[model samples]
Target chain A: AQSVTQLDSHVSVSEGTPVLLRCNYSSSYSPSLFWYVQHPNKGLQLLLKYTSAATLVKGINGFEAEFKKSETSFHLTKPSAHMSDAAEYFCVVSVFNDYKLSFGAGTTVTVRA
Target chain B: GAGVSQSPRYKVAKRGQDVALRCDPISGHVSLFWYQQALGQGPEFLTYFQNEAQLDKSGLPSDRFFAERPEGSVSTLKIQRTQQEDSAVYLCASYWREDNNEQFFGPGTRLTVL
Candidate 1:
């Protein structure tokens, strides 16, 4: 039983301001975590993944996420928001036993001008 | 060179009609996955295939839903006696066997059972 929980359903941020989307997980083993972004009418694109490697994982488009084991969280962040960053973000977790992936409800990010 | 691809990007069906969706994984990929996504929700796993073998289908909603990847590359998902609750976006993803964890997704087949 692995599960992911995204704290925010929708988040709004100014174009030039910093952005953060929170996510937490519950897994029985050391889990592999991933962040995926999906633009409107488009497929999901991988942002980053943490596979028992680095705790701080950097991804495409200047985005990154920190895997905090003690806190049971993996929150995505970016220094500055861009209009193109507006999309749906999903936090996924895969357990060590199986390749099955568990996904959070998803967080919709809206970049304001 | 191409990513995972799916056919019939959008489809509308009558309540009792039968529909089939197809998927073509990236060349050489060994794993394929099928998921269903409802509005304002995350994708839910329906089935998985390793090569031509249908490995796991524990997430399938009912017996009416069936999937096959007989050739190890191309796959199809069929739904019989469709109901309104079956309306959702059906997503297909693929990954290499050695790297089965990170999957590349297709644009998905949007099915609307009316």
Candidate 2:
């Protein structure tokens, strides 16, 4: 079985400040991790994905995530926050060669001006 | 150039009524998926299709939910005798192929059952 846990339900950050959204995973096989962002009334957009490549992955909108197999964590981070970044973020996990993806509860990000 | 698209962006059905939601995946994509998302939660997988073949329906909540993709380009999810609990956003996603990890999502259809 594979699953993902998003640590924070909501996170607030001031503009230009760093942002961090934590996630942990449990999977029996080598896992593929991903971060997706959903704006209000919009579809989910893939921010980044890790497929056993480099431990550090960069994504769209200047976002990045580090895959730490030891910690069973893949936390998303951004050096600076912007107002447009406010949205719901989901942590997702799927095992290698598997099509089914397991999603986390999601974390709501609010960027302050 | 267009992404995954879904029709009937919003729908309302009375109890015991049947409803159908549609999805059109990206051109040439080989995999399509349906998911249900409740308020304030993440999307839950409902079913999966690979080129008109219904490969997985394990996530569907009940037998009342039926999905089909005849030509491999468009798919429909039909719900029978909808209940209030069925009210939620239904999302559709697609993968270019089995080897791809990224799945493009559609705007989703909001279903309200009264």
Candidate 3:
């Protein structure tokens, strides 16, 4: 079984400030990691993915995540927060390229003006 | 290019009522998936379909749930005897077997079982 843990339920940051959302994963075997963003009443949008190609992965909207195998963490970070970034984010994992996705509880982001 | 689309963006059903949700995947996408997202929680996989074939449905909560993709493009998920616990947003995503493993998603159908 594979699962992901989002360390924060809600994160509030000021505009133009760096944003950080923590996530960790546990899997019995090799897995693929993904970060998806969901605006209110919207579908999940892929932010970035880690297929073991690079330790550090960059995504759209100035967001990025690092795959730390030893720490079992894949934390998402953005150089600057945008008001539009206020939404829910999920950390997902699929065991060994399996299509089935196991998502984290989700972290709600709030960007203050 | 159109992404995945779901009908009845919002649905309200009384307990014991049956509901059917539709999903129209991106053209040429060979795989489709269903997921359920409860309030304050992330989405959970419900089933998977490849073309007109259902390869796996292990995530379906119970026999009350049924899905089909007869023509290999449009798919439907049917829930019988809906209960209060079934109130959630039903999400549909489609993927192409080739290229990256990314799945395009739809806005989803929010089912409220009152």
Candidate 4:
């Protein structure tokens, strides 16, 4: 019954500029959060995860996300966008004890020069 | 590759045809999952297996959809008399029990129903 809603369907950012992809969730219980990225013709890869240990979670490739309980958001951010960062990103939710995931619609990121 | 892998990376089936998709999880992974991804959308969970036991199949769309991991390593998702709505990318993921938080994904098998 839990789900994630991605605020932006597409995001465009210039190289070296900051990038933000928003996500919100609706869950009856406190849930673990994750961000996964899918590059062209490749499999989905884990970017980072928030498992209640930290509000701010750092991930691979200079990416990070913050879990805000008040806002019900776990928006992904990067200080400087790289050309390779252009890919489809998904916000995922998993409940305590149960590892099956619920995914957001996804946000397509495009990095320009 | 060290990552998960799915066979028949692309499959095209006529309506009412039966199709089977295969998934090879990373060696020693204890948990396996199946998901469906429609065009322009994120993948949706379909089923889960722990070792050789089928745990949760609540996400499966219909009874026509069937999945199995008899030996607990390789799994297959079979669709009987497929419909147009079944056209999507079938994704397979594997999770090592030690790393409970992350799931490694395979390059999904794109099933196209005509």
Best by lDDT: 2
Q: DockQ for the candidate 4 complex?
A: 0.71
Q: Indicate the residue-level lDDT of B106 in model 1.
A: 94
lDDT string for model 1 (B1-114, tens) is 399899999999999999999999999999999999998999999999999999999999999999999989999999999999999999999989644489899999999998
Candidate number that wins on lDDT, 2 or 3: 2
Q: What's model 3's lDDT at B97?
A: 78
Residues A1-113 of candidate 3: C-alpha lDDT, one tens digit per residue: 99999999999999999999999999998879999999998999999999879999999989999999999999999999999999999999987658899999999999999
Is candidate 1 or 3 superior in DockQ? 1
Error of 3 at A106 (Å): 0.3
Clashing pairs in 4: none
What iRMS does model 3 reach?
A: 1.7
Q: Show how many residue pairs clash in every candidate, following the order shown.
A: 0, 0, 0, 0
List the candidate 2 regions with Cα displacement exceeding 4 Å.
none
True interface contacts retained by model 4 = 0.74
Candidate 3 structure quality by residue, lDDT tens digits, B10-29: 99999999999999999999
What's model 1's TM-score? Answer: 0.98
Worst 10 residues of 1 chain B by lDDT: B94-103
Q: Residue by residue across A1-113, what tens digits does model 1's lDDT show?
A: 89999999999999989999999999999999999999987888999999898999999999999999999999999999999999999999998647788989999999999
Better model by lDDT: candidate 1 vs candidate 2:
2
Candidate 1 CAPRI category: medium
